[model samples]
Target chain A: MIQLEKIEKTYTAGTVQTPVLKGISFSIHAGEYVAIMGASGTGKSTLMHILGCLDKPTGGRYRLDDIDMVNLDDEALSHLRNGKIGFVFQQFHLLDRATALRNVMLPLIYAKEYPADAHQRAEKALTAVGLAERMSYKPNQLSGGQQQRVAIARALITDPAILLADEPTGNLDSKSGTEVMAIFQRLHRDGRTIILVTHDRNVADHARRVIVLKDGQVAEDRLVAQPRDAESELAAVVDEEVRP
Target chain B: MRTLRIAQEGARALAAHKLRTFFMMAGTIVGIAALTVIMAVGKGTEKKVMKRVNAFGTHAIMITAGGGKGFSPPQAGITTLRLEDAEAIRSQVQGIDVVAPFAVRRDSSTKAGSNQLQTIVMAVGADWHDAWEWYTTDGEPITAEDNSTMARVCLLGTLSASDLFGSQNAIGEDIQIGNVRFKVKGILEPRGTSPMGDEFDRRIVIPLTTGMRRVFNQDYITNIRVTVKDSRQIESIAKEIRQLLHERHHITPPRDDDFAIFSAADIAKMARGISGTLTYLLIALAGLSLLVGGIVLMNILLISVGERTKEIGLRRALGATQGDVFHQFLVESLSVTILGMVAGSVLGWVVSITLARLTQSPVVISWESFALAIGFALVVGVFFGVQPARRAAKLRPVDALR
Candidate 1:
């Protein structure tokens, strides 16, 4: 569960103050699949950073799982992030020198109580992402689509409370993008809470609800009557390629 | 366990880039190797100096009848030194223990039965044995009676006895010293080579009175050996003896005194020749290598930190504390230096053995060198590693991610 009350972020350089997020408020319950959409300069990145607990809002109260993150110190925030939130970056920032399995097991290295079955858990996560045969492969050895899948496996290995994806399909081809979307739809159906942040309308339409930001404020927040089905789109793409 | 895991990550990075790690370790290797060699050579030189000092007699000072720097064999034909000078030093000097005046013949042809050879022969008083701490191992020593009565008995050194008599016993046998036949009374104890690289075991000894009256026919002795009660006061007593000699001989500073005095301390200095300067130069080399090595290690680590900014951000986002990152970098640095220390120690050991074999000198390798090397490695590792670690830990996650 997450809650925001008038979250505001301002950057200061010398004597000049620049406000990035102005009086933004939102709430999302557990197991909810939602998308936050905005163009560049609409404070989309600033809000995403706050939501991921990477940075603090200058003026606001943000509660994730009943703990107000505003008062937590940097060290406590890191532990909180490890325990509650899993992140999938647009660049798929996996360690280049590490194997896919090692990348998935990275979060457990920083866990307060390292699990004894960490290796097995990483294997299962990688298998769930359709990378069972490529567990030992490095990032450079994987394609764009497979690298993204490895990043997803890494994100889910900790079994965090919420999954936050920032432009998860931005760097993939159309076919890989559809496949990634299908995986997300399947996760949503399995009662997992998902927060998808992107500027693409087509990407945001895959979620059950969408919130759009304009000029550092929420301009639209509504439920989609009929969300696009990514599984069928992937099947259609495969069929089109096979027919040729 | 957490720290171990983080340290493992640092080790993995080093393993990944082996050349970079080796470059970081180069300076430490050279510096520690030089340090180890210096310790070995220094300890070996000190041992040699002690041995030579002990051989020359720690409590004795020799006043040779010659005007020259450094210890040399008693200058032949310098007839100014006499038995009265030995008596004056014994009566006038405060710390005098025994004063024995002796004359030396460098090349004297001697014969025993059919064997004949040329060797040095010393004419000494009864106190010479106490003054040199030398005594006959197998037969009677020269006594005051022998010197007083001008006895015809003489002592043969171990080598000289073997040279003149072969396997047969030379004691109670007769030997000729420059056509003067004398009966051998004893075999002197074996003494090793002198500081001047002459064999002390290959010489003969006779009573001073007999030598002056019947043998060489010289009235003046060539050397006065003074043994002091306290070895610590030997240098000052030598100074006093010099002044007494200067006044007795009526010589001033402008006129070079026809005498030279040498103590055990001078022998030590002579034995340690050139090694002191060599040690100082090695110390400078060791210091410079360590200093420059530490600087190079620090600069490379700083550059590595800059290059790994993205990786740092990723680790931070994955819940690594700044302390974890700092610990990782510090571990990386310490590993390089510590590993280099081990390699350098082995290299130094090989070089030390080669030096000992090639130069035929003692090279002592002790545990202290290894301990000191570890100390230096840890110091350089920690000193150079902190700044790069701090810089890495200070990077903000958000900014670093961008």
Candidate 2:
């Protein structure tokens, strides 16, 4: 669960005051699938960073699972980022020199309660992402889709409370994007809370709720009674590929 | 467990830039190696000096020409030491045994048949062997008749005999010394070396009268060698001889001695003192080299930190603490220096061994060299690594991610 009360973020560079996010307030319950959509410079990414605990709001109250995140120190914040929340980015920032298995095991290396069966857990995470056979391959050796899958596997390895994806399909082709969406859909069905940030309307359609940002504030929040089914859509696309 | 993981990560990061890592370590290697060599050579010099003094024996004392309690400084004038002064010390000094007065002049050309070589000529009394306790291995010692007649009969040191005659018999053979013909009486046995690294067996010897009257034509002797009856009385004998010489030269207060007397222990202490200064100079040089190496390592690590900004952000996102990243960089530098330390030690050992063989001094490696090499590596690792590590630790994940 997450809570925000009038979250605001301002940046000042050499006496030039710039506001990135202004008086934004929202909350997401357990197992909820929410999407935040905005155009370029709409502060959607900044909002996502605040939500994911990667950055703090300058003027706001932020609570994650009944803990006051606003008062938590940097070490506590890092621990929350490491275990309570998992992040996926468009860049899929896997270390190029590390193998996919090592990348998947990355979060465990920093975990306060490191699991004893780390290798098995990493292998299982990779398999869940359909990358078990390519676990030993480095980021440079894998394709863009495969690297993104490895990054997803790394995010999943920690089994965090919430999954936050920022423009997850921004850099992918349609088919790979469809596959990724299918995986996310499956994760949501398995009762994982999800927060997706995107500028694409099509990507937003997959979520149960959509929140749109205009300028530096939230413009709309609407519940989708019947969300698009990503698994069925992926299957239809594959069928079309075979027929073509 | 976290520390081990961090070290592994550091090693993996270093493996990414193999050439860069190796070049950084090369700087430390040269520094440690230079330190090792200086220590070994310095220790070896001290040992050589101490050994020479011990070999020279404490019962013998030496008197040079100038250094006495007089208006003249030591060894400044044409030479005041005379055969009469030596005889006077032999008679007046109670502990005195054999007083063999001697003088040395260098750059005299000796010719035997067609073989010619420049050699030092030593003028000695007949009691030279008795004072030195060094004897002729072949024929006989210089006689009183030879000194009184100023005879042309002479003895040769082992090396000089070999140089002049090769494998031929030197005894009873004729050799030309400064255009004067002399017959070789005997070949003296080998006497190893002086504390100053000069070989003692390379000089040509002649009777004191023959050397001073015919060759040099000087009435005064340059120095006198006095052998005491007991080693315990050697120092006291030196003092008594000094007093008699000062009184005879009319030396009093407020005047520097025209001569200086050094017992065997004094010679050894002087040698140790000289080598001690050399050791300090070499350590300073080693410290300079380590500083240079540390600077180079710091700059390279700074460049590495700059290049790895994205990686740092990613690690922070993955739950790495600021302390974790700092430890990683510090460990990386320590690893490089440790690698260099091992290699530099081996290099230094090999070089010192070669030097010992060339100089004929014992190969000595002090424990301080090892401690210094290891200590420098650790200090440099921390000193150079901290700045870059702190810079990396201070990077904001949000800004870095951008």
Candidate 3:
């Protein structure tokens, strides 16, 4: 579960104070697939940062799993992020020198008690993302779709409560984007809490709920009548390719 | 355990970029190598100096005939230095211990049975044994009766005895030195080599009375060997002897005297020669290289921190503390220097051994030098590593991830 009450974030520069997120409040229960939708400069990235515990809100109270994150120091926040939040970036920020398996195992290295079966856990996570045969492949050697999948595997390895993805399909081809969306749908169906942040309506259509932001404030919050099924969309794209 | 794992990550990064790691290590290697070599040569030079000082007698002063600035052997055919001057030093000097007047003749023809050779022959008093602290190892020493009676007896140096007798017992044997058949009364103790690089055990010795009355036919001696009661007082006593000789010989300023005095201190100085300056120069080089090397290492580490900003951000987001990042960088630096120290010590040993073989000078390889090298490596490693580590640790994850 997550809660944000009137979160306000202001950027200070010399003589000017620019308001990014002004008095925005929202809440999402466990196992909910939600999409936070906003265009550039609409403060979606700022909200994502605050949600991931990477940055503190200037004035507000944010709670995750019944604990207030706003009062925690940087070190405590880092530990909280490692244990509770799994992040997938638009760039698929995997270490270029590390293999997919190593990239997946990176989060566990920072855990307070290192798991003795870390290698096995990384392997299992990579296999769950359909990268069983490409465990040793580096990011540069993997396809854009496969690299994003590896990032997904890395995010899931820590078994965090929330999977926060910021434009997960931003850099992928349509077919590859469909495959990633399909993976997210499968994860959502398995009762994982997923928050998809993106500027595109098509990406938001894959989630069960959409919260649209306009001018640093929430403009719409509605449940989808019938969400787009990414698995079926991916099959239709494959069918189209085979027919051509 | 966490620190160790983080340090291993640092090591892994260094291993991944081996060329950069080697570049970082170069300065430490050269600096430590120079330091090791300087220590080796310095210790070796000190050992040589001690040996020469011991050989020249720590408390003894030699007033050689004929004037010279450097420590040289007594000049041949100098008639001004006499037995009376030795007596004057024995009676007048305050800390006088022993005063032995002696003469030396080089290239004297000596023969035993059918063997013949030309060598130095010395004419010394009974106190020569105490003054030189060199006594006969095999037979009776030259006594006062031998000088008073003008006895036709001599002492054979170990090498001279071996050269003439050839494995035969040389004591009590007859040896002819320039038409005088003298009985070998003793075999002197073996002295390895002189400070002048001559064989000390290759000379022959006879009484002063016989040498002056029968063999050399001269009343003037060539050198006065004076030993003081205390070695610390040797230099002052030597100065006093020089003054007495100046007054007795009626010599003043601007007029060169007929004798030159050398003490144990002078011998040590001559033995050390330019090595002291050479040691200082090498130490400076060692220090400069280490300083320059540490700076270069720091700059490279700073650049590496800049280059790996994304990696650092990723790690931070993955839950690494600021202390973790700092520790990793420090570990990288320490590993470079410690590894370089090992390589440099081996290199220094090879160079030192090669130098010793080529120059035939002593090169002492000591564990103290290795320990000191380790100490220097740690200092350079930690000193240069901290700033870059601090810089890396100061980066905000939000800013770095951008």
Candidate 4:
């Protein structure tokens, strides 16, 4: 569970202070699949950063599992991020030198009480993402879609309570994007909380609930009457846009 | 677990950029190697000089003719010192043991078999062996009868004997010096070199009477070497001898006595001065190289930190604390430095050994020198590594990710 009360974020350059997120408030319940839709400068990425504990809110209280996060230092915030949240970026920032399996095992390195079966857990995460056969491959060897899958697997290896994705399918073709959306839908069905930030309407439609941001504030927050199923959409696949 | 992972990640990162890592470590390697060599050579030269000082017995003192400032060694035909002055120093000066007067001729070419070489022909008295603390390795030293009769018997230096005889026994063999053929009565032990860089093994010794009568035909001996009854009394004994020499020669200050007395410490001090300056010069050069090496390491590490901004962001995003990032870079730098120290130690020893062999000098590398070089290298690693590591650690995850 996550909660934020009038979170304010501002960027200053010399004498001028420009507001990016102006008194925005929201909450996402546990095991919910939520999509945040916004254009450039709407501060969706900044909100995602605050939600993932990668950064602190400029002015407001942020609570995750009933613990206040605003006053936490960088080290304590890092521990919170390590244990409670997993992140996936558009660029799929998998280490180029490491194998997918090693990338998946990376989060465990920061875990305070590391699991004895870290390799097996990482392997299971990779298997869940349909990358079991390609775990030994490096990020460069993988397609954009496969690299994103590896990132997801790495994010999932920590068994985090919240999965935060910032435009997960931005770099992939429609076919690979559909495949990634199917995995996200399956994770949601398995009772995992997923928060996806995207500009694409079709990508936002894959989630059950959507929150559209306009001018640094939430314009609309509503649940879909009938959410689009990624698996059913993927079944009508076309072959022309294969990843090159 | 975290520490191990950080170390592994650092190693992987270094291995990814092999050329940069090698260049970074080259400075430390060469720096430490140069330091090792300088330390070895300094100690070795000191030992060699001390051995030379010991060759001239610590209990002995010499009064030489015609020198200013430093002690002037006795050379052939100085004429300022006489045999009577030596007898007076022996009888009148308390703590005096024995006085051996030396009459010398240099550049006396000698031939034995096919070997011909330039050597000094010094005529010394029967007290030479006792006053110099020297004796023959084979056969007998010059006797009182040999000095009294002015016999044509001589002692061959070890190196000169080897040069002429070539493994053949030198005793009883005749060696031709100029037109005279003197029979070798004994061979002196190898004494190597003097502190003044003079080769001790290239000379032959004959009786003082033979040198006065036949060799140079000079009535005056060149120098007098005297041994003291107590080694500790040389300073007082030297003072007494100086007064006696000035009185006997009938010379006063500002009139220039034309003779100088040198205790064993004087020669040792002079030798130490030469070696000390040389050691300081070598160490300065070594230190400069290490400084240059450290600068190179710092610059390259800074560049490396700048280039790895994205990797740093990714690690931070993966829940790495700033301390983790700092520790990672530091470990990377220290790893290379430690590796260089190990490699440099072996490489430096090899280089120093080869250099010593070429220069025909001993090379002494003490354990403390090795330890000091390694300790200095570790300090350099930490000193140069901290700045880059701190810079990397201070990078914000959001900014670095961009």
Error of 4 at A54 (Å): 1.5
Backbone clashes per model, in order?
Answer: 0, 11, 0, 0
Model 2 gets an lDDT of 0.85
Worst 10-residue stretch by lDDT in candidate 2 chain B? B68-77
Over the stretch B215-295, how does candidate 1's per-residue lDDT look in tens digits?
889899989988999999988998999999999999998899899999988898899899999999999999899999999
lDDT of 2 at B13: 84
Taking chain A by itself, what TM-score does each prediction score?
0.99, 0.97, 0.99, 0.96
- What lDDT tens digits, residue by residue, belong to model 3 across residues B176-290? 9999999999999998888888888999999988998889898899988999999989888999999999998999989998899999999999999999999999999999998
Q: Which portions of model 4 show Cα errors greater than 4 Å?
A: A238-244, B58-60, B66-75, B87-131, B135-219, B226-282
Each candidate's DockQ: 0.72, 0.52, 0.66, 0.58
- Candidates in descending DockQ order: 1, 3, 4, 2
Ranking, TM-score, top scorer first: 3, 1, 4, 2
**Candidate 3: tens digits of C-alpha lDDT, residues A98-125:** 8999899888877888889999999998
Compute each candidate's TM-score over C-alphas. 0.95, 0.75, 0.96, 0.82
Model 1, position B268, has a per-residue lDDT of 86
Candidate 4 C-alpha lDDT tens digits along B93-208: 88788898887677888998779978888889999989888889999999999999999999998888988888899999998887788999998888877655677887899999
| Distance from true location, Cα of B118 in model 3, Å | 1.6
By TM-score, the best candidate is: 3
Per-residue lDDT for A39-118 in model 1, tens only?
98999988988998989999989999999999999889888888888888899999898999999999888888889999
- Residue B292, model 4: lDDT of 81
Q: Cα lDDT for residue B295, model 2?
A: 86
Native contacts present in candidate 1, fraction = 0.56
DockQ winner, 1 or 2: 1
Clashing pairs in 1: none
